[model samples]
Target: MLIMATKLNKKLLKTLSAVLFSAVVFVGCNDFFGDKTDLSFIDLPEFTNRDIAYVPIQPAWDQFVYPTDICIGFDELLYVVDEATQQIIGLDESGREQGRFSVPGVTSVTQDRRFDLLACGTLDTVSASGDPITLACIYRIRLLNQNGQYGIRYARIVNKIIHPFYSRSNVNAQDLTVRFGKVAIMASDIPSQNNRYYVTRQGQGGSSILGPNDAVLIFSNTDQFETPISVSTSSGIFNNFFQKPSGIATYAVPPQIQASQERHFFYSSVDPANELKVQFIEYIETDFGAEFRPVIFPVGDTSRADGFLFEPNKFSKPSAIAVAGDNTRFLFVVDEEKDSLFQFTRDGFEGVLPPPATGRTKLEKASFGGTGNGLTQFNRPSGVGYYRRIVYVADSGNGRILRFRLTLDFN
Candidate 1:
């Protein structure tokens, strides 16, 4: 039983070394990300073995010049708004064009349960000198069925929603989201600074860039958008600084084993320093009104923070976050830069939840089929929303909306 004696044979020794090396490599290759991967040494599990799956959706219609935002109608039709074309295109589930509409001055679109849509844009007016600048405007689009297809017939100006003050109100609405009968609007001005009440206060020695920290305006219970309640994310916790809130969704499910309703709001903050941060603000009702406290989640590793970009870059900056219906623990984020999707479990956050298994982890975290060549496959993936078990992605860059089914059983 003297096994060491076998080392005397050169051929056997070489085979033994090869077997050991293969075992080591196999042990190191257990990854759970996606079709694309990033880390050099990290080899992902082959897609076939893993329970995860993806179906590429092709556009049924022509591509928009530069699609930016998207939303799904209650009827299950997908609507896309293109910034370059200044037009709204509709597509069926199969990716074919169902209908289309045009606007004079519109930039983005968001839809609600009422089958009403919110169109955001900057109203441009010429000065006496003939130079053009933008003023903020939001239009509520009412859709009607014309010959078995959806059509946009009437648009109304949503003046005076949540923020009632409106002194020199030049906030250009960027994103619109509606939940629990409340429509949320986000906007900023010239310096891209946000303030509670933006006031220049004539001759008070104001800074050229001074304004209320960025604002989140909430419009509630009115198709007219007349009665608005404004909520500000600025507080001492923000410590007299500024944070920009983008892509908001409301979480209003009943607290488990509790009597009261839980109203939680989730948003992405693209602060230059903390561009990878996602903030969760909870609203607890008090005698006066709603109270705001922000819980911040720093994305990726803080060590490589410099790579984080507020503006679109090669690596994705978490642009939008949405909660899947069945499990609040399942959260999805769309990276506008990489034009990909990332899924994280509740435990994935360093909070009360336990860490999710490798199978239930981040996807699209790296280069697939090698380097820059693979990105051309994606256009500009934007906003994500859900209806029942189905997930909808606004394939903005591709000029179509892709539908997918959410599943688990990662091998």
Candidate 2:
């Protein structure tokens, strides 16, 4: 009877030891339901359609005066042109200021595949009467120093294409009144035309159509004059196609090797008289060399397309435009008059198509804005930029830069 009692005691002791070991293991590991695991995006179906539109990315960059334009360069850096400061400020993806370069009257900027900045600004020259005159100019800024360092502070204006002087040696009365708008750095598979860029010029033209005023003019990679764009429409080759064109964009966006080599671009016009304000032009090779042709869209044909980019009287003042370089190829336009940021699919639809199998048929109207300083609102927003799934807007009247990401892009 004593031995049996001792054996029971030993068994009880062993069981107690095992329980303590288990408790220690649990404590050393995670408590309760183990390490907290975030629910996957799909695990929450309640988010469906509720957060399907663009959501703000908090804490806007609010340090500028009349920020005219913003762009994501080939270097994957953010560049902003501030006309009030007459400077181009460069920043990292985190919005940290990297460097700033001063120009006379910098308004808009675009970077090429070669990483050179092509911007529209003003250059001052002495007239024959010994008076200083500022003419609209295109500047090719090499973001490199003599020591081979890369930075906007080290950037130098290697070349300047002054108005009238770039097109012809002589200047007309209307040339002095001309002002440059935006620059679209073009890309081509051909080596000779790879870095050529297009500049939007505007002027009174002396109330006549004698010159290339209010036109999109092309320049060679070497900064030589190419030709003004003559868009081919259903009405044949139209020389006077652009009216008050202020914004231009190309598909040759950053990360260099991944950029498209297509000679196509999207441009925006602020002209109040035009029915359509935004248009896309493609460089197609024809039997007679090459010509720029406008890509037409079917309007009011819901069965064929939900929306059309060529819809008449759609925009009041589409001041700035951006073409997504990713697989999405989305287009972004910001209207100053309407104070709105509009998004579109590659097919010119008004919004992003609903995700597969959500019991939704129509596209979400992703465009939004008003005349306030809200997260989704803008005050005379003049610039739009896109990279990856993020969109950046230059709220010039508000003196800030706003960023947003579509909720559909959430992981």
Candidate 3:
């Protein structure tokens, strides 16, 4: 009985000590907080699926004219291509204009890992007859001067890749129809392939002694013409795979230091003839050599449906595409006809997954847009950019740039 009583007494003492400790902690907390009638506290850090909505950061920079495309440069600066003025407008992430440089006939702008700007535009020159002629050309705008000063104002035309002349010394009349619409820069650990880019050419379509006009042509870091990307599959190789490819994006995005060596790229086509608007081509290396393959998802089930990125007719006039090189690896596509922005997972799902608490097993559909000047609406939004968890859109028809952040990302 004495031993049993001693054990019971120890247990009771431990329970009492625990109760006393908890009471002291609670009282101390109350003492620290009770004196303050009003307290300021940050919202809970945990984000539930109910908080999964992309909200706009209002008061957009509305000073642009027909901004056709936007790129978040390797420098972490925002570059907007205003096609109407044929200028590339530079801005900080906060929407403040930094500087602007004009490129004749520039329709889209891309930045390489070297911080140089590659613009798809036209070059005005006199033909053999001394007649003024405009030809599709890719201009390499060196943002740094001989002194190594860097700024948009310091930008100068250091190199030019004219249509047929880029490949051969001679230029022909048939090459006149070729237009370079977009350029996507690639980063490779291999020195020889570093800073390479792919340019989309459109206007003519043919398989001749010269490659097809409507195709994606690769270029070296020196701006020299490389071979076009040939999409090969189990069946065969396709030289003329792209149809007026409107936008091309590589895994190598901005931030010079963290740029990806990934050669895979996402490309979009606005051509009415292209039944499928957006496509992803992955680079695969084999003993035979390196070959590019297109990622194909079965769209067989009609209901194989809304959330899948490859769903039939999912996009209308997809003007541009951007891929996150960060951990998210999210995909962004802006459509002109639909006037909306779509987000997808790297594996091709429509939206981010919902939290377990949401009582939903599917991803929360977050893609949104419409016509108008409202905060979320975009008019002919031709470009989409991603950086630091923010989405920037070039509201072309609205003559402005708008930004958004997912509520779950807010502090």
Candidate 4:
């Protein structure tokens, strides 16, 4: 045991060094989030594509030209929004066309807790003083029942702020989500300059160019715009301001845990960017007013102050996101560019941030579908909704709606 050790050969030394380096790299890549467990090796349940329903598009009559969004009503019926046709078509559980309502220049649709369908779009109308103005507004439609007939009535309109100087409203409503009797509308070109809204004049006259502050405008259940929550990228906290806030999904906290939580609402956003990232924000109520606090969830080896997940190469133009109702255990995101749906689970991460990784929250589980027109594929899928363990996808490019069910493994 006291004998002098033999000098190692140069080749052997190099081999040992290479082996150590490889081991370090492997550990660094796999356990970047300071977790001992490897997420790639975690066994999770897979999502199976059960059925696909195509909306009839023909020469005589076209039901859906470019379906952009979808919502699940209180009655469990599916409402699909078509941008090209400017209509929200209702489909039964079996994917049959039940009824359709026209909403001109429609961009997004959602059903409130009262079973009233809320449609967000642009409309041409006169201002309060009778001036011609184009405005972005939300229309609430009530479901009527008479003689076994599915009659729909246009109830009221919640008009967004329109600048008196400009002919059209500066706000460009992208998406809307209703939760806890509150409506959150994602918009761009928010009035910020000296509390005034301005837009750059294109073409021959283009000098008055004023930038806008993108925001999430809050509205009450009575269809009134309350205040605008501006999302700023200037602070070192946020990675960037939302360029194109496409879709939003809200999660309501359960009653049992509501007392202990300062943040009641958990919302996710899908912004179209070069590197698609999913932004998570918690709706916190402060003494001043309601605030949207960005949650910095750990993803891979880094911690993002603005987003929970970041995979630019994998996500190509993510359009929409949906979380399990009341249960934040599962989440789904629709990638329009890749034409696929990504599933995430709250297995390894914490539910809340700041005190990060204290409790199990959610992480990416698996992904399914691809770019195609087949039954098991998607073409530029836009909106996604989860209800009663079933996921409904608005396959915009293919003019259809695809549904899938979650297959959980107790073992």
Candidate 5:
């Protein structure tokens, strides 16, 4: 009887040890490994659809074949870029056609700090020797009043060529943002081409050629191309690899931060898995010089890629992003594939981590315009812009611009 009891006691001890060991492993996995399988998608607040306010389809203006971008000028006018016509059409706050300007190969437009209109496009100009030179450049235009009529006059052109040896075809300026007299341009490389270009503060004349990657070229206050931030480097803040950068936006960091002098910019790219990825980059003034580096922001207890707040399946081919100027907390992302508009608060991702953390960076609101050519719907919406409390969407398929007023009830 004693021998049998001893064996039973030994077996009980072994079973308890095994259980304790399993518990330790489970705890370690939760604390250290961040067991993503246990995470669930965040339940976001429902978006209530209000009535669509205005749809600008002016018969006086040429039909928009493909409106790629839109921006609000200091004059409170909406500037729409028609890629098919290579022209910019201006409209008043009430959606009345104000005027239009011809800009050849114009892809994007923005207002500078000085209230001058800056446009990025491809230009063909003659050199001193009468040789025709086609270059991708930024044109500064001033809105002038001629006999009570508004007109656009060419201020100057910044020819973006780092070296003469490089073919002009290598430089393609897609999107740009101008702030504090500085312009950050997203210049995409030719598809399947490995050569890249970077701009220096020394002006377009001092631009440099990088090996190959999608890059953001920074133009200094003097209107010179100053630095190139690439996505291929492991050193900067963005350690992830991405290609095919599509859209860009710039926002100002508050003065209280340690790096207040720096400028914050966001660029979007398609990852290898075809996921739309957006990252936040900062132009830091270092001891060496002004450099563009990646930044990480707080997300819950852990941190994540600064501007990368979306999940892998969050967007299907996100084409454009726009941040609200009046309320910086609002961010709008347009998915061209699904014809969906996702709205998120900047603070929504505070405690969430990626990989099945569905609710982590909760989407504050979402609007789905089923694929159609209707007044309320969008067909292949390409770009979005927000100003005041109004949201402007480039309904490219419908050949018109749609404006909507957002009514959020966070309560």
Candidate 6:
């Protein structure tokens, strides 16, 4: 009996030891195990016809063959810049094309009529080797209606308006925004001609020094506007830095948190060789100004080369992005290559809500892909804007304007 009791105690001790060992191993391997499975996207039902809003273009402004970027103004008007013709057109609320005006050496337009301001970036110079020159200054314009033909009455030249402070090229300020006496610009440029290493890195997939912007540049204080904060980098990853900075919007939550955390800014990027990486960066208002780095999403997280798993075979080249209202976890993106528009949402922190049920929304059948839309397929679709119930796209290649009004809600 004594020997049997001793044996039982020994068995219990061994079992307890094994359990403790297993617990330790489990704790240590949790992150590894989680990473083992593909967590970039969630396994959800393919999108059906649930969330979609498609509207046709009114025939007037449809004259553009290649449209570059779009802006919304005060009188329920839509303005589109045609880089090809150096012209800008206006569209009325009913989708009817009103008339057109011209801009000298102007390639883009960015403005919100509600704020009574507009801005654009110009390719000031170019090298004989055909490389684009620096974006010297951001031209500001004020929209006015002169007997129905829209006119740019107010203008100013702001020099060296580069945001995130790392972009080598300049912005097409037409991709920027002005609201509540604040000018929020998404300035992008490939690394400038600093050294041969910068050029080679951009060409050979090497590290880009000033390509990725360190922060969204802000020019505030006109009416008590504050200077912008800067973005930082812990990882050295950089290149094609600001290849495409489509849209800029501010997130203001007031009467809530401390004044410092009241506002945030979100911007988007579409990097192809970088694994078709579509990234959203958030800028927090710190003691100085805007602070930013890439925000990690559980889903849609992968190296720049994994390619978009959803459309692996199709060539995915995204261009523009816009956030949804009510501060939802969704964004509208345009793929210039496909000439199709996609709606993506954050499914928790781990998955991207797939494209809407209507599948891919077509802006115009003939000029839907490539750069711009017009009587032709989009030549080089570039910028996008969302407000109230409507969505706007910059049909850069076609020099035309396209608009879509959201008719359905996505739960």
TM-score of each: 0.57, 0.85, 0.84, 0.59, 0.60, 0.52
Per-residue lDDT of candidate 2, residues 1-411 (tens digit): 334434755687687668666755655546675874432432211112333577788789988888989989888899999989999999998889998899898888888777788888988887767778888988889997889899887999999889878656666567788998988877777889888888888887633334458998888999998778888878898778999888988888764465677888899989999898998888899787988998886577675445668889889999899988788888999999999998887777887766665656677677778899877889999999988789999999999999989866866
Candidate 5, residues 1-411, lDDT tens digits: the string is: 334434755687687678666755775565676853431343322222322112232222225778877877655677888878988777776766666787767766776443456666665766556666665556666675435444343233433332221323333322112111113322222322111122211111222343233445555433554445543235554412334555666542111112112245665654446543655665566687654565553443333323335454556666677665543455677667777665555543411122232333432224546687655577787778877666788877777777765432111
> Model 5, 89: alpha-carbon shift in Å?
1.0
Q: How many pairs in model 5 have backbone atoms within 3 A of each other, for residues 3 or more apart or on separate chains, i.e. clashes?
A: 12
lDDT of 1 at 184: 34
Count of residue pairs whose backbone atoms collide, per candidate: 16, 0, 1, 6, 12, 52
| Candidate 3 lDDT for residue 160 | 83
Per-prediction RMSD in angstroms?
13.4, 12.9, 11.6, 16.8, 19.5, 21.2
TM-score, prediction 1? 0.57
- lDDT ranking from best candidate downward: 2, 3, 5, 4, 1, 6
Encode model 3's per-residue lDDT on 292-391: one tens digit a residue. 9999855433232357678778887998999877788889999999999999878787877655555656676689888999888889998888888889
Worst 10 residues of 6 by lDDT: 193-202
User: Least lDDT summed over 10 consecutive residues: which range in candidate 4?
Assistant: 197-206
Candidate 5, residue 240: Cα displacement in angstroms equals 10
- Maximum-TM-score candidate: 2
lDDT of 4 by residue, 139-161 (tens): 66677544444434333343332
Residues 134-165, candidate 1, lDDT per residue (tens digit)?
Answer: 44455566675435544543333444232212
Candidate 6, residues 49-79: lDDT per residue as tens digits? 3232344434424576667666654344666
Model 6 regions lying over 4 Å from their true place: 1-60, 96-101, 112-116, 123-135, 144-216, 221-247, 251-263, 285-290, 300-315, 326-330, 346-379, 396-399, 407-411
* Candidate 5 weakest lDDT stretch, 10 residues: 193-202
- What TM-score does structure 6 among the candidates reach? 0.52
